[model samples]
Target: MMACIQFLLLFCSFMYIFNVNPSCAQIPNSPIRSLVLPVTKDPATFQFLTTIYHGTSREPIRVVLDLGCPSLWLDCSSGRLSSSRRLIPSCSIQCAAAKPNNMSCAFSAAMPTRKRTACGLSTENSIARSATRGELVEDILTVESVDGSKAGPVTTVDHFLFSCAPRFLLNRLARGAQGMLGLGKSRIALPSQLASKFGLQRKFATCLSSSDGLILFGHEPGYDSIFGTEISRSLMYTPLVTSPDGSGSSQDYSINVKSIKINGKRLSLRQKGIGGGTKISTTVPYTTLESSIYSTFIKAYKESATNNYFLNMTVVAPVAPFGLCFSSKEVPSSMLLGPMVPVIDLVLQSEMVKWRVHGRNAMVPVLDEVMCLGFLDGGSKSKTSSSIVIGGFQLEDNLLEFNLGTSMLGFSSSLLTRHTSCSDYHTRMMQSTLKDS
Candidate 1:
């Protein structure tokens, strides 16, 4: 009886222990809802780069943030391949997810002579305007998890699929950047994969600046404490539209712009210019508008600056990229929005929804004495599909939330108006995390 009792006691103890603290394999990982990537702008290239830890070694890999890219791709030759990496076979389900029409696998000329049944993915260098074939491979990826208020412990995603491109494809990318981190709406895009893994809402936010910035994957928490005002509350959203002609990737995000206004005065623009749609690009340094739209905008802006804000401002010689230049001595500065100039408003779906562009975003300083209009004349409508390509300069210091679930883009015009910059918020977040750690 004593032996049986002892056995029963042992069984009971085991059951209690199991219930209290399960084995490592049996314990399911807690879902990490949010992840953050530290973004930094490349001074020479004017491109934004974000860091992600990859492979067994957890090596930090910096990659360009491309909103239109279909998937994350890297120049495999640049970094040591992790032993845990797995090559995806051609015509496999994973390959189909990445490239729907991909049938036969053809190895790149730069690939090794050894024959392997690996999936071939097409990778592009948007800046260099080059395309090359890359092998699809999977490895572990790690990123810092956050809870809106503070940064948490590091979380990882095993078996993260990415392309292995040739070393030559790395040309024209930001210095030290190994590849591109695609945030497009494709199945294999970084944001989509992260959302799927964490069971998070299909949304992400980007706060871009000249220095360090932040990119949050998944639903963001309240920003009231950080920015003085709640970013979610102040965000103005507009429907994300796809181009009719579909010249670029179907996953590319675009918005419908109804009209443009300078200092509350509507600019006379052709309906065709407005109908072409406006696409967001991180690669483009400055905002580019169609020739007709540019002409109308420049004329109206010049008139506004001369008559309203800077009556004594002298028109200096036109800068290389910018057609309009003004003497900085005559241009007044503001505490809230850098230069005291006319506000440029982009009217969206309705008259009520407008993206107000402050002076800081409208003007760029080329020299100590000269400040020029930052906008570029993007040839004709035939040359480019997008009527207006909103570039990185205009997007800097802006808090933009791209919600893939609702197909809506929520934007906080400029963080400067809120008396906070992306760099400031990022620095604080990092410092807070360090202090807590």
Candidate 2:
């Protein structure tokens, strides 16, 4: 009788523990995950996300998340390194060579001696240059998710490999932050590495707001699932173009933009060279139209574009670099979005997926009332190049999904309005995040 009583008591305790802790449940079918991140304002407002890294270092290393580039390299100027970079037993024969270009382990110019040489790398997009040989080491990286998610971006990999550049001149990073996390098409890319370990597809979804945004893996969380989160609207997908040559560098996101329309007219993109399709970028946020394309667009918008957002302010004249300008005396500063602006839509295909860039998204306020067309002229053209580079500003407040398994890029528009001042937006987002915490 006593044995029977003890067994019943033990079973009841076991059931209670299981019910209280849902984390003890077995793994589910979903291999998907999400990484919620806070957006950065300056340099390129709402252009990039600060990636939080978890590694051997004492302090957390924050790196910029760049999807356009193919390699991961950090600015060691500020990084604290006990093991500068762990050298592979063999860098030559057994170790695989890096991509986009024939980037391999070689001696850096700064330290020419073979004995002193670790792996280093360098680039010259306008021209070809020598590779920088450096050391390859493994490290763990993580980012927090939104809605106070307990299970943030989880990695199945034992250890992820990343290149360490001891010293290098990266002008783009000069204006903002240090280091970069490349999520490009290369096999060495972070997404690919994560997929390899888990035997899952190389896919990710990113929702970009001017403030707090989130990134999801595998699939967008459905409300019923454990990784559930509500999405703004329906998703629109466009097929990605596999590079012209087998080389996948520049082609990770080069989508064929059949046509471009401004205010309802077909704007001509007379490429000086042979062929140039449109590509999307996370680094550059302003839409850069070629000189001829810009000319045609400016002519079209000039007739209808009005600056009524700040009538109380002084209506200053246009200045150099900018095609239009305005000023304010009574209003103090210009308004973000004018009363009414001309509709500028980018038609990718049929009416289904029109990347209708909000008027405010296409205009950058250089100074008070001084707004300029966010588009720029592609100084020189390449034979195998992109006609228009859709910058991040155009993608702000939108959810973008990159599915490598299907070779498709999905777009979903959000109804959220952006704040004129990034600082104000960031503060509000941080406060909201804190409240959730």
Candidate 3:
């Protein structure tokens, strides 16, 4: 009897020892790298505008690509129809460790030059359209140098397929992200095909922020750095941001956070180091808020209490008190569902960099009220700029806020909506309950 009991206990212990954590199995590693790859702070992982100009005739097709994929081209001998057909194979390759970059190429036979009829336009209109089109042709040949050493001539590529959207869609792009490039870690993607051509490693990382439509791509540098005065300087003209106040003061300002409150009382923040020994510089500050924001949301949920319909305010707390009010549809609630933003928001103001213990692992705190207006084309060698404003704050502490001055706060006024098609359920509800009477 004793031996039987001992044997059973031993079996249970062995089973427990061998149990594997499902989460650990799935994630594979801690500190998962982001998809938008540029790890460097300077020149910050090239998201640049690329143009494919047909040889000699000066026709060009425009697109945006991560600079990390060095090899990108357009095949001209093939007409647009054939070019798209031929390039499909190249675009279909899988991205793997063995094959690093996803070099997806769209093709165009020639640049659009003559305009015929947009309803009814004559040759005079065509000539004006041609001039506008001429401005889109980017000169392919230029010298690329870093620290006085020539990386090479910014080569003019040919015989590749490039995509041009309907004219209206093209107009929606910022100056540079106007076209597509090969991203995605697939074999047919441009990054993999051009990996050897551009001396890129097998895998490039890209970090994409929904708040800002900025894609950072590049190999991780084994050093610590910062986005310096230069890159920030060039960002000004990049059409990425629109309607800036032009007062330079806002440029230097980082995020400003109001006090952190829990149950309406505030909390203090303290910094802690991340990596130790030689990696000691990485650090982050943390503080737990007293407010049971989740609890409040639960109460709202319970009061409204329909299993099919529920509400959650997606926000990182510790934002400026006023900035926590209005919500923007543009902000993705899922992405900001992390602990970093609110903790950082408690200490810093918009765009300001507050050192998190070690200068290495810092977070850029942004005002909660600020909303990002995707990309504006800052012209001439400029990348896109993300615009923000100072509106949309929570007065009762549960409202959503957008910092950008011109974003949609609550819904538009009923008077304004009388002329437009604003028939969303929320709009209808507001109309039925609040305005119809």
Instruction: Estimate the lDDT of model 2.
Output: 0.52
Can you write out model 1's per-residue Cα lDDT over 1-437, one digit (the tens) per residue? 65564444444433332222333112226657577888899999999998888888998888999998888999877777687888987644566567644423232353244234788888888888899999988888888887556677888777687898998988899889999998998767898777766666778888999899988886545344444456657799999988777655676778998899998999888654576579888889999998888888888888888776335567889989899999888677987698887889989999999888998998898999889999999878763378898999999999888999999999889889878889987898889998887
Where's the lowest-lDDT run of ten residues in candidate 3? Answer: 275-284
| C-alpha RMSD of candidate 3 | 24.7
- Per-residue lDDT tens digits for candidate 3, residues 57-158, read 444555444221222332222333322122122211111111222111112222122111111101001101221110111112211111111111233222
Can you give the TM-score per candidate against the true fold? Answer: 0.88, 0.70, 0.26
> Per-residue CA lDDT of candidate 2, range 242-294, in tens?
54543324624766666666557666654432135567777665677666666
Deviating ranges (above 4 Å) for candidate 2? 1-32, 43-47, 82-85, 89-94, 97-134, 145-157, 172-176, 198-200, 222-233, 243-248, 268-274, 306-316, 324-339, 417-437
Q: Model 1 reaches what TM-score against the true structure?
A: 0.88
RMSD for all candidates, in order, please. 10.2, 12.4, 24.7
Ranking by TM-score: 1, 2, 3
Q: Residue 132 in model 3: shift from native, Å? A: 26
- Assess the local accuracy of residue 18 in candidate 1 as a C-alpha lDDT between 0 and 100: 21
